[model samples]
Target: MSTAIVALCFSGPTLADDVSPELVAFARTQAAHIAARTDVIEHIIAQNTNHAHLTLEEISRLDVHWRQQYGSQDSPLIHRLMNTPLSDALRSLQLRSSELITEIIIMDNRGLNVAQSSVTSDYWQGDEAKWQQTFLLGPGAEHVGELGRDESTGSIQIQVSRTVTDHNGHPIGAVTVGVAPLQF
Candidate 1:
């Protein structure tokens, strides 16, 4: 991540550097649950055959909206953080494991978010890091990242993203999700 983007990626009230023990445990709890579902998210993207994959620019625009609406707020925290719409449907998929679920979303081949969980504000299409290595790392590959502090909850979170593919053996897009340590 460049210093410029990292600067832009963060917003709202800042969090303290001192991470609590509870938060550490929460992040750990979220890891496996998030890990198990990337492949499932990919399946969903694949099924949406009619959906056109978004370009990186489109995703960036959505991120801008997300930031303007949700990221700018500091109250009614849950509203800013919930991905229930996405997660509820995901639950029906009979996931291999239920660990820590924070957020989830589908991205087009061009790296725009199609639909997702816990999306407050969109920014730079999951950062430049994702765009660079997604192909080299393989489909459904996951990346662990610190998603900055949620102004409402004062909690820290780690996010993961997995690539998605269609039946034609083509890379269609990806599913990116996050899990905040329950300790928050």
Candidate 2:
């Protein structure tokens, strides 16, 4: 009984129970920086503005369509999007971040993927807690998602999401950046 109590006390909090304050701060600061980038801001604004009238359901369905099409290796849309200069720019940014950033996913207001550094498990983020919390709460909102190991990168990462607001401070979408805990 005493040993059990001691073990429990020593175990402390799990990553799921709480994210370190330093990592949270790093995420917030990085998210703000990403939001302030001129090109990134412009891209988000343009995507959101173009699809401003889309309802939540419509946006989710669009995500499904994109995901289904991209699943095929010979997908024309994926090839075109992934081979463009824009993709090169995104990949460059990810490389510049070193190992700290494992992945980057930018979503439109409807939670549809606008751009991604790598392919994600899904396209629609509306159903995900990270997207829901940040998007619904608008700008200044942040969500620290689950901690897990990336099989491909073999890095322990936590998904951090923040609202992507426009010039007028209106949230146009959200961006989730994966931070490797060991690097940070």
Candidate 3:
């Protein structure tokens, strides 16, 4: 019984274990999916010194690791980030390539939704899967969750994210992208 108790205590991750196989697999699959497409959203994150690809801290969370932060209502980034409608973005991706990227949400350090590809109009970006990994519980490597759903799809959506950084490599935010694994 004492051994059982010890096993239970050691069962879950304690911020030292290497990232789970599931997470690593999801990350690889997401990168591959995005890489397979060119006209659609590119996995490429670098543009210039001012513009950059998302960072490991930004793109690491997926379905299981709940996000944990949100942007301030008084911030201008909230306005600029959320400016793009989810419908428009989804439509563009859908029209551009045969590849699939069903939803995309901008998550802050706290995991709140700054912007999304669809739904989430009123900012539901706090302590959810996409935002939580970077801010909470682990050795601080990238994470990926298995397929899951939101209020709308009722289908499996693969979540992907990386830490967003500035030109000086300062951590700024996170970006989460979701794609339907198997459309029903």
- Give per-residue CA lDDT, model 1, range 1-184, as digits (tens): 2453344335432232333444445433443344345554454465345335655565566566656666445433324324344544544432322544545555555555444444435533546444335523565555545556644334445555555555554556655545444423
Model 2, 1-184: lDDT tens per residue? Answer: 2463234334542453355567667766777777666777777777778878988777766667667775577665456546655456767777888677887777778777677777665667888887899989998888887667654345567778898888888888888878765665
| Model 3 lDDT tens row, 43-101 | 12222222344454543442112222232345443344445544355446544534455
Taking all chains together, the TM-score of candidate 3 against the true structure is 0.47
Stretch of 10 with least lDDT, candidate 2: 4-13
Better of 2 and 3 by TM-score: 2
TM-score of 2: 0.77
State which candidate, 1 or 3, has the greater lDDT: 1
Q: Please report, in order, the local distance difference test score of every candidate based on alpha carbons.
A: 0.47, 0.71, 0.43
lDDT of 2 at 26: 73
Best to worst by lDDT, what's the order? Answer: 2, 1, 3
Q: Enumerate residue pairs that collide in model 1.
A: 26-181, 26-182, 27-181, 63-122, 66-121, 67-121, 104-117, 105-116
Candidate 3, poorest ten consecutive residues by summed lDDT? 39-48
Off by over 4 Å in 1: 1-62, 71-99, 123-132, 135-140, 146-154, 182-184
